[model samples]
Target: MSEFFAHRRPGRPGLAVFVNAGDPPLALLPELVAMLDENEVDCLELAVPFPGSATDGPVVRASADRALATGVTPRAVLDTVASVRPGLRRLRIALLADWSHTVRGTAPGEFAAAARDAGCDGLLLHGVPPRLRTAHYEAVRRAGLPLVTTCYAVSGPDAVAEAVEHGSAYLYLVAHYGRSGTAAAWDRKRLGAVTATLRSAASAPVAVGFGVRTATDIEFLEGLGAEAAVVGSAGVARMEQARAAGRDPVGELQSFVRELRTPQPSHTPADGRKRGIHP
Candidate 1:
């Protein structure tokens, strides 16, 4: 396992924050990455802008538009990661891209090599299904960069186990069954069941994401036995809000991170026995 995934311990669940590279602008990336690391963000997921993203919500789509408008290319995103890698010594950094972005008019192996050379520890192909991503997985493996795969609630234990057998650094579970940034409260019962299934079937850790917006949500995921909780659109939304208000985006992100890392009372029942949520 990479050092990023190794950060998880007994009591604390990991936090992964996502941001579109060059959304507000690429110049701010180094500082933003540094700030996240300083504030205890375990993983920094750097999203490369691609057109017509089917899974992106309005906030993420707007950020992608802004990034594309600023001429952010795959190469530029890689370069930015390389520049920030040294500063983020302990933080695990991963690149999130679509199949098109990963291919980039080159062979999959070649593209993976480029990303590895640019200092990314792992790669997550956002819209590609695990069964259909053999070539991409092999390429990432050949480059020695970990491949992060997504598992949906609907995808049963058999599928998740197969993905683990195929060698994923970790499995990313979609907390809800829709686009990112949807405001629905997570289905705690379903989430608990699915997480339990994944944990029992797979050796790799499971990280839940999609529609995760607040500290309470993070706490809930931790309670559900998730190895990490990913926050994408929520973080971007906050950054946009900070910029509009003439506030420091880094400071805003730091405040949010601190809130997430803060310890809170357990959700144990009054009888003092821990509730039966499967780990």
Candidate 2:
């Protein structure tokens, strides 16, 4: 089983934290990574800063801007991962989508290979492109890198079901419609229903993201049968706040993870069969 899958089975949902490489500084990234690992994070998603980030809101976009200001590129992010790779055991690193493809060109295979060589375990293509043209997704998966594709509420439940049928290594469910926030804007009841339908059809793990800023947000997803919760803007924003406050940023992060890992009562799905955690 993949490291991601292995972490999600039979217990609680895996917490996948996202960090923008070069946000604080490239030199500080490895230490930040070590902090997350010490906190027992299941997987890490490293955002390779790009010039443009359409899917990201103000918080993430601002961080990306700062990273770009520091000249953080895809290569820089890979280098950071390479330095910390040897120290990790059973950890998966997923590279965020390439900016160029989102705006300019087609998906870049070489870019994916570069990330793989640098010890990245997967790829996260942010939005489900209009004409998905699964060629590149297939290429990266063939190379042993699981490509995660997201389906939002606006895409409708049918699209979500179809994504599962087509074989997403992981199906990203956007619970919230807009910017990352302290409270979830998504309709919990509706999202739960959609999640139920998707889980019934999806061949892969269904992970929730977007505006999932707190442990409470996670509890909601777990209840809905999601196997993983993606926390990005919240964690990154917290990391920045810690830095600005002159606190031990890493220590603070470790504490945050502990809160996330706390056990919660599982919810029985609508189908009556309890869904196993997606390790």
Task: List, residue by residue over 146-198, the lDDT tens digit for candidate 2.
Answer: 66667775677566755675545577787766665434356656777778877
Tens-digit lDDT string for candidate 1 (181-278): 87755667788888988878777678889877667677778878898889898888988999899998878888878877777665666664432222
Point to the candidate with the largest lDDT: 1
- TM-score: which candidate is best? 1
- What TM-scores do the predictions have? 0.89, 0.83
For candidate 2, give the lDDT of residue 105: 59
User: Whole-model lDDT, candidate 2?
Assistant: 0.71
Error of 1 at 199 (Å): 1.7
Show pairs that collide, candidate 2: 5-279, 6-279, 7-279, 8-277, 8-278, 8-279, 9-279
